[model samples]
Target: MKSPSPGRSSAVRSMRSAPFFTPIRVVFSFAGPSARRPLSFFSPTIRPSAWRGRPWKALRLVPLLSQNFKAEVVAVLMLILFFSWCYCSYVLGCWRLNIALSWFWWRHLDAGLHAVMHGDFRTRHDIQAGLFWIYSLLSHRAMEYYYGARELKGNGMSKHWWHHIYPNDPGRDPDWSTMTGVAWVRRHTSAQWHPCHQWQCWYWLPVSMFLEPLFELIQVACALLEAVASLLEPPMNGPYVSRWAHVLGFLCEVLFNPGFQLVAFGVQPFWKALGVLLLARATSRLLLYPFSEVQHYMPEHILNREAADDSAEWVIGQLLCTANLEFRNRWAWLMDFLMFHGDSHQIEHHLWPAMSFVQYTKASQVVRATCARLRLPYYTVGYFEGYQKICEQVKEHRKPPPRPKRPRSPGEEPSPSESSSTRTRRRTRGS
Candidate 1:
């Protein structure tokens, strides 16, 4: 036989090296380089291989629901449950529980009674602190795992990890974030009232102990009922109740109970409950306002500010004025997670909002490194420490000492620089 041509020999060698030298390869081998023109088109075929076959199948289910009445019914049911849970946990559970519990505790106390009435800060601290811990422990593990898995799968960059990872259809992009009503309220209020709002202290102090409890109680009852209903009924495995009942339950147990308890017990005078309620409403605005300032108000942190110019700018502006409390202590971490770790992780969450708690630690490490490189402050501390700092600032602002005018040096004129230096010295002296 004639010796194989060099091209043929090379093709034979390539065939041996290739993983699947099937009929297609043989056909291509005979077609020569001119046929290679079409091979480039086949490259995209490999891209689909990266996704497991199941992901595509799973993704196909998204569009099925939009076509018929059954799907719409299911969708509506899911939405209702979601709204109910949100209302119950946040509004009634957190706000109401705080007021109820606080009122209960306060009824028996003297006029001078306070959270510190139990001798030390332990009683009041325990209530908030315990709630925070419980919330963190129950929710953090699952949330972290869910979030971490998304990060590992290259889907952790978005705000709502669940919807993105398992998108219902082609119409929606895989990485979209949705804001609930409460979240919206929190964001808008915080953004509108920081730094420039001199009434922040007056707003937050009393409200936390009164009006918030009533709303919170409504949330709590709703959550409790939903959870109980879930346990009694064979889980509908519906979109709303199946996946999120635990979230509602956790919120009720952690946030609602303590907040309400604090309100009831922390404040005194049964008649003052009205004042406390008004204060609670104002403080709700204050807490949310500062929170929004830091997250939604700030330009860098605002999610979709460009679309809604006013809202976006408002959020960015809030972040600029508001400060974050970074918790570092293990206990503090536990407490914050329990009470509403979201508040504690505000800065980091804004920085890498999609990362799960597990991945958040790693993401936070990277964040710390980046912040260090940029010479920016990374405010991470213990929960208690952060809370203490806020309290101190509030207290200081509320009862600021009258600034005494500087005594003019005998026969010497007071200069602007000298006055500033004197003020600075005084401010720092005790602080």
Candidate 2:
């Protein structure tokens, strides 16, 4: 074996000295309400380091329980701003700002999904109604129409936890289904390869970036079918199982909802309304997808549960699987805003899933320094570098896997050369 460089050897020694997987002791104080309850954590938590204090305390700088209303307020404000923007752009004919406002609104709503994890929003009903209305009216998604506020919040939290629990684990992580290219476009994992994926690297960018409308339309079509089914025979599960609510929700999605933006656009033609809706969704996806994907798509980080070393500490697995975007001091806030907050500092988000983005920003320094001191892998890349990294990963998987030769037809025997080579290969595998 070749000898490692002096720097590489020293790095290895540091990592070995401070192992990544450190046992975590969690102590829960059950005296208070579940949301307000304080969790006492012993150190060497997440990963081994000299630090002995509660890591959650550092991450949650804000009074999350008391300040949840503030998050709800922000959500309401975002909804107002989006509608206000829609009025100015769509009604007043300032259509150039359409994509920009829609994109911002979409990002905020997407972040609202994260905000829901924090829990106990007094305005949950209002917020959920606004969100459902926005998606249904603008994106023509009937499924959103069916789900009420509580269901939306529950589903969002469950999915978020699942993704964090198994970040970057193909077949296990729910996000993988979306990340591994939609429809025919495939980003092959090591365990799964297909010939179509050979050209994925070449066309993925253009297709994903520009053709979001087509995908959105497909989703809308599927949702429409689902909506019909629900109306005819309501789901046996979920709060809104009644056929009456299904009919009402479907009506709200289509024509009767006060939240519909087309009315503000002033009696626009059906095609025009649909065109605007598609354009909005397409632009939002373009702005959001590329940045949102950067955290998990790093080739080296995507691993199975066994390979991820989950036995050590799940938090260690999170750190390994997730990456962050490096931002300059002056532009960190801007990047955070653009990346839908907390997403730029995804390691912290994964570490403290319940904490808000404000806390993520505040605690990012502590987390980064902790990782550095512990000799843990804390991946961060520039925006361009991260995007290029994703493309490189796709390109790396572009080669089609070698296939075995077809068996000799029915009764026919293989050639003598083929039989001998097969026998030798089988023996080698056995040995």
Candidate 3:
């Protein structure tokens, strides 16, 4: 075999050190006698390096927990506890609780709107007249339930209706890939709001708000009835079955109540459910518009038109398409969470969508470093600061004054000094 050039030998050695290309380097090393001297000299050191050692050690340890019966039992117990708490909290409303609460108010507003539209303006105050305290309590409960269900569904790892209803199903696999499902939703449904586009109608807003309160109150009443009924039933034998029942209870609270609210009061209520929905929509647009522009609209990150394959590029595309929300102010963090702060750890979520929110922050530092190496945008802004900027951009886009087109002159000649002055002005403006 011919001797390899020194540059080629160095390049091969470098490629071998890289994690993914290591196997290729090993193959090349064995194929050429000229590769042996450099390989033997450098390969031993590379193979035993701490960088290589830690990952291999960690990989080896993963199966040990499964192999040991005691460890497996402990793992299962921990998993049960974790999921149980998640289910209870989801049913009880730890996330987006305000939305559920506002459902009651939405019902009232919806009713009033309907009454007004039907030329019953006198009924406007009637919805709130006798129902103030009841509506308020139901609203709070509904908000709690709404946020709880959202968190439960998000944490459940499945986008399916069945999974939302019975999340703790032992047969249910929580690690199913969300990319395809999320992509389908993004393509078929609006990213900023629910898949149903009916909420966009302006007239429905008041009606929804008016009727939501009453609808939510009925849901709460039904839930209490179901709980009392469950208590009267024979106790479930298996732990899984009991867990499933608890999950079902939460599902009942979330779906049955809200489901009835939508169906009985009609879909018109969502249109008039203005307070929380409006705030949520406005907050989301403010956060996402600039975010989308920076991550997707920018020339550097835009998806290629000619490339039919969206495989490897899509992963990179996600990293490029999302930016981190860095909060400088303490209040910004609270506000961010209130308005989809899950977005702050976006890159990590994209990389490992199944990971719990608790794990996301831990993974963020590593993900950020990886993104930095790739030269992708890792956007971080103080919560309110970013929100304010996005609002400003929206206002700018909305402001109307069309620029007049400059008229073209036929064979216009400019003096050298005039041209130089214009060039200077153009350069200054460009800078």
Candidate 4:
């Protein structure tokens, strides 16, 4: 076989260096208000001193459903860099770079979606819809894998807003159990409980870690089917179907889909690179989900519609449903940083969804102090403690729920069925 091109090798090497360089670059560019600089590129162009002691003011600083255009553009460029690395590594058979880049891809998976969620970069004339249309093509690689291809008007923002509206309601929350595997193994709500879930606490952590790649594959297949179906039907257009539409839809869904570009699979080197990709996907989820998943649906928050307090004040309801991850050490903070602080200060994020991640540090302080003063539940558990608590919650609900006792008037005799059962129990005990 001819040796791989030297230029390709050099490009792969350069791409591999991104894992090291990007974080440092991102740290400097996205620096928090506490940094010596006036303000960082990633934050909104506001005075650094304006960030202190005024979380409510910070909320007013950014309008609802708005984002910093330039900062979000830079974030998108970072996403593209990581995505390009994944593509090149796969095509060029650079397994090491491919494996390394997969983690970067998974780490930024939420960040990518959130960037799009936060802003449209002030685009014009339905361009934001087109942007989502394009992102919907690639979003399956993220944790919100299924339903990645949403209707233009009904894209992630709508879906996310729906989640906020119903946070942990049993049936209404779209994110209740997006991962089908977790839905089976653990009950995020009492309604989700099954007898089989009893064993989940023991095995779920290990087993679900490897299932991420499997979930990815399933999501890719689902996206392909959806793409083909959408093309054939061509929503809102006339119902006249053509034969060429069928052929082109099949080709695009199988061949051109960003999630599963199949051209390199015929090559031997692709298999090695694929293994790394799968491993990276699995490993990243293994590390990331414990931090991310524990943010909501804890034991105290296992609410169904009937039991949920829909009438509660908005901020209190948000606080009740969302929990923040606390980092006690530098290592934990590093992990939080890698997660884009999405899990840390989650309570603040839920309360003020439009605030930039860089603004979270100051916002969290204010939120924490106010929660303390008001004596509201401010759940900020250490990373491992949060993980274990969520697992314990799963275990606690594994058994069947205890039967509610029948109420009776004073000195009332048992009903016929109840008396017969009581006699049978007496006879069995005597025997």
Q: How high is each candidate's TM-score?
A: 0.28, 0.66, 0.30, 0.62
List model 4 lDDT by residue over 1-431, tens digit each: 01122221221223224443332122122222211221121132322332344443434343332234543454556556755664576466666665555554555545544544443232331333333333433443331332222122123333455566567654666666553333656554435556667777777765666664567677767765664565566546532242233333334333423234454465536666356546666666666665657664554565433344766555667777777878778876654554453457777777665454655766777777777776877777776786687677667667666778979989999999999999999999999
Model 2 Cα lDDT, one tens digit per residue, 40-152: 11112323332234643343343323235554565556566666775676566555676556666555544554444232132344443344334333333323222222233
| 374-415 per-residue lDDT for model 3 (tens digits) | 565565555455545533433333323345766658887776
- Candidate no. 2 TM-score: 0.66
Candidate order by lDDT, highest to lowest? 2, 4, 3, 1
How high is the CA lDDT of each candidate model? 0.34, 0.51, 0.35, 0.51
Q: Candidate 2: where are CA atoms >4 Å away?
A: 1-73, 120-157, 179-182, 190-197, 210-212, 225-229, 232-266, 329-332, 338-341, 404-431
Instruction: Report, for all candidates in order, the number of backbone clashes.
Output: 60, 0, 36, 0
How well is each residue in 197-229 modelled by candidate 1, as lDDT tens digits? 355456554544455555665775586567556
Candidate closer to the true structure by TM-score (higher is better), 1 or 3: 3
**RMSD from true fold, candidate 4:** 13.3
Question: Cα deviation of 75 in candidate 2 (Å)?
Answer: 3.6
Better of 1 and 2 by lDDT: 2
* CA error at residue 81 for candidate 2, angstroms: 1.5
lDDT for position 271 in model 1 = 47
